[model samples]
Structure formats: C-alpha cells, structure tokens
Target: MSTSSEHTFTSPFRNFSREEWKRLNGQLSHSIREEDLDQLHALNEPLTMQEIEEVYIPLAHLLELHISKFQELHASSNEFFKRNHQKLPFIIGIAGSVAVGKSTTARVLKKVLALLPSKPKVELVTTDGFLYPNKELIKRDILNRKGFPESYDTKKILRFLADIKSGKSQVTVPLYSHLEYDVLPNEKLVISQPDVLIVEGINVLQVNSRKNGVFVSDFFDYSIYVDADEKNIVSWYINRFESLRATAFQNSASYFHKYANLTTEESLAMAINIWNEINKPNLHQNILPTRYRADLILKKSAQHFVKRIKVRKI
Candidate 1:
C-alpha cells in the first residue's frame, strides 16, 4: 500500500493509513453485534468485526461530532432569527461505483448511528428507488444504460431531496426490487422526520444543472464515496453476480432467472461481458468523476477491507 505522504501535495484529502485511522477510535464503544453485521453485509461482500471496529467505528464517531456541531449551528441561527425553528434531518449521501459496497456501508452507518447515545431516529434510502421503471427505460430505449445518470429520474430525486431538506413531516419514495430488477409499481417507502438520513447510490455525488435550478449535493450535510481500484471492483461485481445467480436468480420469478442455469464458465463470461459493456463504462464516465466531491472517501483493498480513509482537508 502507498503511504499518504506520497500523495499529500496532489490530493485534496489528508489520507490516513489504516493503522493511523484506527487510533482515532479512541474511547468510543460500538454496539454492532455479529448478528447486526450479518444483516448489513451485502451479497459476496462480508465485513468482519475487526474491519467494523477499525473503519466504521471511527467513521461513526466523526459523524456524531459533525451532527452535534450542526445542531449547535441550527440552534444559534434560530436564536438570531428570534423564531422557533423545526429541526431538519442531517442528510448524508453515500456514493460509489456499482458493487463497491456503498449499500453495506449505508446500512452499517444507519444501524450504528441509531445506537448512539442520542438514539436519534435514522433512515436509509437508496437512489435506486428513484430510477425510472423498466417500462420507461424500454420506452426510452436506454435499458442498457440503467445505472447511468441519464437513466435516473433526476428531477424527481431533486424534488424528493428538496422536500426532505425543507423539513417536510413525511415524504414518500418509490420502492425498487433487485429480484424484479425494476421499480415496484405503486409501492412507496414513507419516511417521517428522522434525525439522520443516509442516501446511497452511484450518482449521489453527481452535480447537475437543471432548467429549474442546481439541486442535489447542495442538500447534503456530509457525503462519502467508497472507492477501490477498477479491477478490484470489477472482480467484486463478477463475484456478486455469481452469488446472485446461485441464490436470487434461482427463483422462478427472478428477473435474472435465465442466468441461474448457466454453466460456471458461461456465468463468468457473461459477468465479465456485463462489466465491460455496462458497469465499467458507467463507473468510469459517471461515478469516478464525482468521487472528489465527497467529504470523505473510503478506499478499499482487493480483499474489500478499507485500507485507508481520505478526509477532505478543512
């Protein structure tokens, strides 16, 4: 692994080696049990207890520090205005390439943050839910570009974030199903006011100029970008695809059921093709470019453990 000192002059972040980062854990204690980790782990991406202690515990503690500061700022602003103000959720955006484990990171943070002494309500939502339905994608003839920025319902996502940031009491988000591989019709996830909201997706860090206005990252209080070498991420994606083929794709109604009967060789070939044709291009063109926008970046090793953390310099 390269040392942070090597990149100090060029990088926007002050990189911390794993050992240096772990020491930041200090006296903080976590309640993340093995069972909690089991549920949070994504397909083919397992997080060990040691990794959780070293990486996530310190990250969560940093978040608590940010949240406390935000609360104090909010209170001071209210005092200056001489008006009673409602507390809005502190929004956190998590972005990364497909199969880089952003989902697992989001789930872990939600669970860990909820267990904090504050015991504040926490909610997790994925931008996958804001993707246009399969029908809409087919109509646009962009089904092959499903994860690209153009394939998302960007306007709707902006509105949703706007509503949340405006302190709406309740907001409803569409639901997406991985097995069905599309947005579920007429299904919605309603989120009431929460103390913290984690929005995870490939494009959460992307900034767009809308005809209405610029929206998206402006609403985020903090953001994270999970990162790894492209080769490593591709390997993880292929492994995950194989795992899904053996499990979810085995279901008769699974959208990817056709892959279940493929020979091991055929499965690996198809996964590689999917990576080359779709996922890889999407990561390079859309996802990777937005990584520098994140407040922090979690760089992973080939084994999928976070080897270093890059905190944007103040």
Candidate 2:
C-alpha cells in the first residue's frame, strides 16, 4: 500500500532548497476560491511573493504530495479489506496551539488536496462540530476551558468516525456556530465518505489507548501539528480576536457581545487576558503535549508562516 519516490526532499522541510523554493513560489498555487477560504479568520496577512514562495507555497505543494499518497494507500487497503471484510473512511488529524495558524493550514490543505487529480471529493470535517453545546459546558462549569480536550464529546466524535469508517457513505455531524459559541443541535452537517478526510482542530489526536479509549486520531492514515513559539501565537490570537470582533461580532447573534462593546483598549486587554488565562494554558497542558504524536510537524515563525518542517522518518 506504499510507494517510495526518489524525490530529494522526503518531506516539506528537507526538500526546500533556495532555487526550488523560488520555483515553487511561481509554479504552484491551489485553485483556491475566495469563497472557499472566507471561513478562515486569520493568516490572510498581506505577505510578499517571497513569503508566499518561501513558506506557504512550498507547504501547499508538500500537502499535495501527502494527501495523494494517503488516498492511494487507503484505496488499496479498502479494496483488500473488501475481499474478506468491511472497510472504513480514511481519517486525518490536525492539531496545534491557539494561534498557530493551524486553521489556515487546514483550510489551505483542504483546498489544495481537493484540487489533486486523484482526490476532488476530499472532505474537511472539523472537531468544532463535536464541541458540546454551550448549555452542557455551562452546566458542567467548564465553560471557560471551552477548547481544551475535555471540553468535547469525545465519545460522540469516536462514534461518528467509526460510522464513516464502517463504510457509511454519509454521516451526520453536529454543527458549531462561532456567532453563538456553541454546538447547534438543530443543525447537522452531513459528511460523505471522501477520498481524503481532513479533521482539523486544537486537539484532534489525544487518545488513552491503554483504557481502550476510542479517538478519531486512532483512525488516521496520518496526522499533522502546526507549531510556533507561545509568545508569537499569543500575539496572533489577539490580532485574530480583534479581527473577529470587528467582523463577526458585528452580528447581533455574537455571544461575545460584552467583548464586542468594549473600547479598543479594553478589548485588547481582555483578549490578552483570555489568551493568557485560558487558551495559553490549554496549549501548555493539553495541546503542546501531543506534538510528539504527530506524523509530521510544521514549524512556523512569528509572522505565522512555516519555517521548518519535521516529518517522522517513516
């Protein structure tokens, strides 16, 4: 179910040379529709052609390779299993810190992979869909730690994954509305079996296998972690919070109404406070600890773009 190519760069990082990076910058670009990327809240900073080439562009091309190989191997395995058993969907996990630009990475990868000749039907199912409804979090008194691994209905997520993997062509997943800050029970997003399934969120890979723990990550053909310094991520988080406040918070349904009305200084201060008190702590405790579990790691700089990549030597 695997084929080894003699490409000089085995992964994104090792393969990017000065000349090749420049060439990739000019040669490769996803057929990214502006509408498809409108959901991405950050990482759309006006970067130079060099920044696109040296960082985002190469990563785009690298993801293309990772996704193509993933589909090829998964299809072969599914066919083999069909001879004697049932088959399942190919799952993938994307995890990282609060402001590490993982969301943008996932969206970009989804766009890029979908454009792959072999995987036009790829599906990107985010764990945001699995977040427990706000009422449940408030009742449980864990409302403040909303993005922590414990904040989700992991069991439901496992069952959803299992259903898709069991060859259910289509499965329904809960939908989370950022405007309301909760999972909307009445709203369900249907996920069809796709050539590649990209599951992106803050904590998609934590599993307690010793306890027979069921996790979405356990079903993945591969996993990725986006990394950057804590300080840089904090800054990025604050910036994104401001951007969202100005944009999404303008809607009447935004749960952060109190935050939305704050003065510029007050809003900035509150954003940093939330970052330090909640999101950063979650990163240090729940998210960062899972770095070692990633099949590949994309390390980004303070500008929120990748600088180095570490792929587990298969």
lDDT values for all models: 0.89, 0.71
TM-score of each: 0.94, 0.81
For residues 165-240, write the lDDT of model 2, one tens digit per residue.
7778789988888788888879888987676678888878665311255556887778888888888878888888
Best by the TM-score measure = 1
Candidate 1, 42-124: lDDT as tens digits: 98887988987899888988999999999899989889999777998999999999999999999988887887778889999
Clashes of each: 0, 2
RMSD of each: 3.6, 6.4
Q: lDDT score of model 1?
A: 0.89
Candidate 1 weakest lDDT stretch, 10 residues: 206-215
lDDT of 2: 0.71
